[model samples]
Target: MKKMIAVMSGLAMIMTVSSTVYADFGFATEPDEVAAVVQAYIDEKLPGKAVIEISEAGEVIVKINKTSFLNPNQQVNILTENLRSYLLSNDADYSIVRVVYDEEATQPAEPTGPEEPAEPEEPAEPEEPAEPEEPTEPEKPAELVDPEKPEEPEKPTESTEPVEPENPAEPAKTIKPGDLDSSGTIDVTDLTEVSLALLGDRNLTDDQLKAADVDGDGTLSLADLAKLRQYLSKKIDSLD
Candidate 1:
């Protein structure tokens, strides 16, 4: 039993030592290992000025301390090309973290106090304006009168005086004595009608007989026809 216990103690010591050494061989923290890698890159690429810093705040932070970094533009160029190649080749998981300077350490901020609230000013009271007086209406002037009385309008004259009507002209007579055919004169036509009546060759109307009688005799004969011919020859002035 004593021999077995001694062997068991020796085995446990060797296991503890081996595990400790193995852990030591590995990275202390992933961030520290990344910082170390970044530092080597800075030294190789940047040379004398820039460096990488690793620290623990609430968590491990890898920051680029650019306190004496000579060329920021050159460092930026290296980060884009060489740094990206390094991370990709090494399979680093720092794609999301933006590498920038730890400026909060170099420049300390001044302490400030809470500012006092400003007092509000009271609004001024508005003044009341005076009421305007009503405007007075001007008095109307007396109606103008003409000194001379206007001429009295002329009264319309009534047609009281009796109107004298003009005499009417007599109508023209359609028949004449000795005008046998009522041809408007005692001529050969009247004689010819009387001759025709004597011979009974033509019938004579009462007005024709009246026209055929040239001497104002009631009867029509050869004597009346001769008188008509004489009148036509202008031997008698009037056949009235």
Candidate 2:
């Protein structure tokens, strides 16, 4: 009676441990879910003759049969690549242990002997030649030189006067810095134009752009706007 109670307790303990493991690893509630997935993967790769066995203890075994054979270590390489990738990516815990291969599962079928080479055929007899015809004369070579020579080109006359270089384009007019509206003075309108340019709605011309570069940094950024505002408020004498 005591032994019977102990055995029942042991069974209950086993069930509790199994449930704990499944909960921790996110194992499927259905007993066949993982096994079915593994079976399908093996079926797709090895077709009808390969079997996959997944144990409740998280062990995996691959069995290759005689009816289907892989091409020399192809089974090992394919399984290692496919299973490791699937587990690492899809398995909740990214863990797989005790993967075993059944090497002596079944004997591979013997290959048929190589085919014999076909016998060579004899050469056919040559036909009789026709009577020799009279030898024909060779054609004359083409003429090497033309009868007339080309006329010589006339030389251009040299100019006695010296040539003058073209005048360069006038440089852009330099304006006082912060003169955004080209009013020749820093005013509220110039500050408003600079603000609009900074907002990106309005564009400034080359001279205006240079003028608005109050910090002389060669760029018309927000710092230029701040400088212009400070200048308008009499915070500074000139941006130069």
Candidate 3:
């Protein structure tokens, strides 16, 4: 039964061949940095009847046949597990896998559409301006009085007694030292003048502010202020 031995040996050989081919390497995944290099290797080796899925999430799924016509174990260990390890070393975190079932090649769903940006709000219209205030009528002016009717000059006297020509009155210089502050008093306004003098602010308009600044050391300063205080103190004492 040399014939029986031959048949049995042949059967054993066939079964071993079948098991080598049909084993599985399981996962679903995406393309990563090493994706291109891995892909090139796979394309060169497996060629056809293989699928690669590269998800946007960076999951890499390499699906090969449960039955490769060529080196079958090579398809599982070296290609599948080594690829997973390479991706891990490069920074990919979680991943899943499954064998390529002879029945179906699962395709992940496509996203619907790009997200739309939000719109800006429209500005509200400004409220209309309020009505302008009404103007009031001015009061009537008082009638002018006749100076000729006063006792001082009811009429020109018919004087024949040598009405000597009256001398012309001199123009009045009304700016008094006390009037600098215009309070009709010689108090703080004069002191303020001294202060300005200390600051070199000598451009006084009324000449009143400058004149009250008696110490005229040219500029307004604490020196002038102190002088003013002393002058005022003396003046006040004299008033008693």
Give the range where candidate 1 is weakest over 10 consecutive residues by summed lDDT: 101-110
Global lDDT scores for all candidate models: 0.64, 0.70, 0.57
Location of the lowest summed lDDT over 10 successive residues in candidate 2: 91-100
Q: With candidate 2 superimposed using the best TM-score fit, by how many Å does residue 95's alpha carbon deviate from the native?
A: 90
| Candidate 1 local lDDT, residue 154 | 97
lDDT of 3 by residue, 1-240 (tens): 999999999999997765454333222123453455455555666565456677666555667664455465655665566656654554432244322333243233457797787788889999999999899889889988888785564777787887788998988666654346566676776676656655777556646655554555544446556666776878434211
Model 2 per-residue lDDT tens digits across residues 15-61: 88986897778764342555555665665665655566566676555
Question: What is the descending TM-score order?
Answer: 2, 1, 3
- TM-score to native of every candidate shown: 0.27, 0.30, 0.22
**TM-score winner between candidates 1 and 2:** 2
TM-score comparison, 1 vs 3, better candidate:
1
Question: What CA RMSD would you report for each candidate?
Answer: 33.3, 20.2, 23.3
Q: For candidate 1, what is the lDDT?
A: 0.64
